[model samples]
Target: MTPLGVFFLSIGLAVLLGTARGSMRRLVLGGGLSLGVAFFAFPFSRALGFLSRDALDPTLLALVPVFPWLALVPVLGGLVWLLALRPQWAAWSGILGGGGLALLGLLAQAQPTQLVRLVPLYGLMEGVTAVGVGLGVFLLRPFQRGWWSLVLAVGLGGLAFSWLNTQGHLYLPKMVGYYKLLLPAPPGAEEKLVAEYNASLPEKNAVLKELGQPLLRPIASLRDLEGGLPQEAAEAGYRLLQPSQLQYGALAIFALSGLMLGGGLVLLRRPSLWEMGDPKAALILTGVLSTLLPAFEATEFKLQKLAKGWPFLVQFVDKAWPPNLANPEAGIFPLQSVLSEMLLTVEIALVGTFLAAVCAVPTSFLAARNLTRGSAPMRVVFAIMRAFYNVDRGVDTLILALVFVAAVGLGPFAGVLAMAIHSLADLGKLYSEAIENADRGPIEALEATGAAGVNVLRWAILPQVLPLFVSYTLYRFEINFRVSVVLGLVGAGGIGYFIKGAMDAGHYDQMIIGVIAIVVVVNLIDFASSWLRSRMV
Candidate 1:
């Protein structure tokens, strides 16, 4: 038969066998037969060139001729049949299968390559097969224990592994390079530096040779500046900032402050703080600390360095203050340009929040579990929507702004698009939770009165959730406004753009003005959002 014909025949047989009501012996025999057919059909289709090699791994392709000897299909079918006889075994088998598939995916991600593309398709095929077997067993015998905790543990483990692996491959090397760049040069380094620079470009060296003592002039200039005041101070600062030069008094103070902070974190009686009594929360905290502590140590978080730099920081502040409010070319405590950009930032936030709210309203209803509970298809739709929300929120707003800037060209419009997309995800999640927790009585009552779905949603769900939605939107507006200001650093056109320009040009006076404007605008928005949420609640 053709590959397409074989594919349909295998699926039809499996479905028929799966739906058949029979004794344990009959079901197992039928299931084994179906598995054998599907296994053989897969190889046959691949051999016929109907299934692309790109879509099927070589290992599977090689297994076609040896299908009868493989025995994997019949063995798995037998295991499922045996598990169907015991509820405990069936549930444990499902949990194990799911966890194993997830771990395989994680391992594949850690070593991603062209081959990794095949892993997902292979995993999906195996996962579907396992789930189908589990469901068939479940129909014959149900296992009712809580399996959610097992799933959560597997998921968290996979995520933690992926994060640590990524950090090792990406962040650790970058950090090493950064600190190496900051290292102090040894004495008589000018000759070595000149040699390296000359060696890097032979053409430049040849030109310099023709110019008689070509390298000597540049080397002399470097040597002459080697004993400068700035160099001396930098060398001195580097020495003073070393761990060996850390004062005992500073160490004592740091230890005492840490102790106090740790005590407060443990003893504080607040709703926001994690309860020490909760084992799960404690475990999560421990995991976080375990991951962060090594990173902090690697970065060498030194209190003594801050203390040594205090004098330089003070001198910088002294020079930066006393605003240049007179010069038109550079001066302006609050420049007209800065004020207008701040206003544009606010408008971007407002428009973005409005756009997000409009998009999220309908999407949130589709995502809410309680609303989508009655239908299996709707529940699947809900899962897909929630996954999209997670992906949208997982990406940073600044990164999103950079992407949009590339597509749409740099301006406030790029910032607006970034804010709107990110806020859509955030507000969709918040709105869905609110909708899911809305009073169900009104919905049921409306449905009893023969109200249409739209009418029921309008009369029952919206009234209960609208106030919270409005309040959350205002709160998000405050957040997006701050984000918009930062987005300006990437050419998204806000106060941050001016701030970045000032910093690049060493115009601290202008930069300070822009900073003050942002602070004032953010504070005003915070106050307004707080009052609005309070009144709405």
Candidate 2:
């Protein structure tokens, strides 16, 4: 076999080995991760190969010799197995798959206009597929209980939400015009905007200029303008009003049934369907919400020029809020300005995570029941730390920043503090878990050797769990990186605030640049964290 083929084989064997041993679970994880890194390293697999190529003739491309599918089948199967087993696999898959498929369809099979028209359909399909597959795996796995359900729920919700955004819809309520409602530019601001528009208006007699005037079309009603939905969503140009009706009806039925199911369960003194570990029921409920919310908030908008042969209803949705197909108007920040904002975001995340990690180790020991020997005083102290963790984790960093901005004011300082507090709580929990899970044999043996509590902990517990703790810290840092950006939206200072500001200013191009930068940074961080964790633990 060729070097690439041999590498792929080794990766597969390693992953299978890791998956087999409970103690060596991380090994399987590391193996899977190595395979991904290797795949990307291949020149043929790089985006440049797929994206830069404009080969129209298969015969000509064949002369260059792309690797046959047989060479990569093991890699493909490995990825598929990972997706079926790993929660995070779905997210990356959706991003790559959805983006690639849409791009391919646009470049090869359909016009830009047609591609836009199909955005919602593709997005829905992707969401459904990811959720179904993930939940199916969850059903097959017994250990995924307790907090695992919450993790799965969040993952699925996030996927569906991401899918919705990909379809050109922000997937928000109709009333939420902009992510945050604008108060008509403070009255005089509207007049100023109007005057500005009029001054820049193309001459009415200019035919080409007249055509461009209607580029964005007007929303026919408040409903039409709801959440910037593309208006031309009539199935293949077939106009259908209340496409959302089916969604609404499903929501209504589910909600009613959920209520009934809950009530019946209560009356009968039994668990509800969701309580019965019914992921399907939970997913149905999730889907119903996904569908119903947009329908109820559908808006009406009027487009002057027909961008595509969209059904009138589809067009209405499109005009209200630009769907994933047609780009949203860039906010104030242009593409050029995105880099600075993203850099700052990454900086804040790294600093904040490091700070949190430093503080968490000590607190975790104090909070661990095992280390505390279940002593009442110690338990009480631990209880207090636990309370702090709960409260810190419960409130999202964004909200904390809102409060912190009022107390400490803006800038990265506020963001850092917010992230630190949240991370402390998170890391504390993880540390405690590590302490709890450590092999008790060595710890007990140390105590039997007449070692003091402090010495036992220092000699036995710390060494065993330090690696796990480090891994968790790195993991949290990666999360904090993303969270800090999100918090920036609320003016906590990061890329998010800039992106949000750009969106408010209707600078679509700038918004796109900011968003693109964020995606790239987050994915990079995720990759790094995965690699680092694999090596450490």
TM-scores of the candidates are 0.51, 0.43
Each prediction's total of clashing residue pairs, residues at least 3 apart in sequence or on different chains, is: 0, 40
Candidate 1 residue-wise lDDT, 1-537, digit = tens: 322233234334433433442111222222323333323222211111112221221221233232223344335534543542342243333233222322322232232111011111223333333455545454444335436544544454455445434554364443221211112235644444446544555666678798885452334323232222122222332111111122222222122222222222222222122222333332343345345544554687778889999998897677657544447675544477788888998998999999999999999999999989889999999999999999999998999999999999989999999999999999999999999999989999999999999999999999999999999999899889888889999999988898898888877766777888888888898988898888887
Which digits, one per residue and each the tens of the lDDT, describe model 2 over residues 406-513? 898878888988898888889989999889889999988998999997898889998999898878888888888889888887778878887788678765545666
Evaluated against the true structure, the overall lDDT of model 2 is 0.51
RMSD of each: 22.8, 22.6
- Off-target runs (Cα >4 Å) in candidate 2 are 1-336
Model 1 weakest lDDT span, ten residues long: 112-121
What is each predicted model's overall lDDT from 0 to 1?
A: 0.56, 0.51
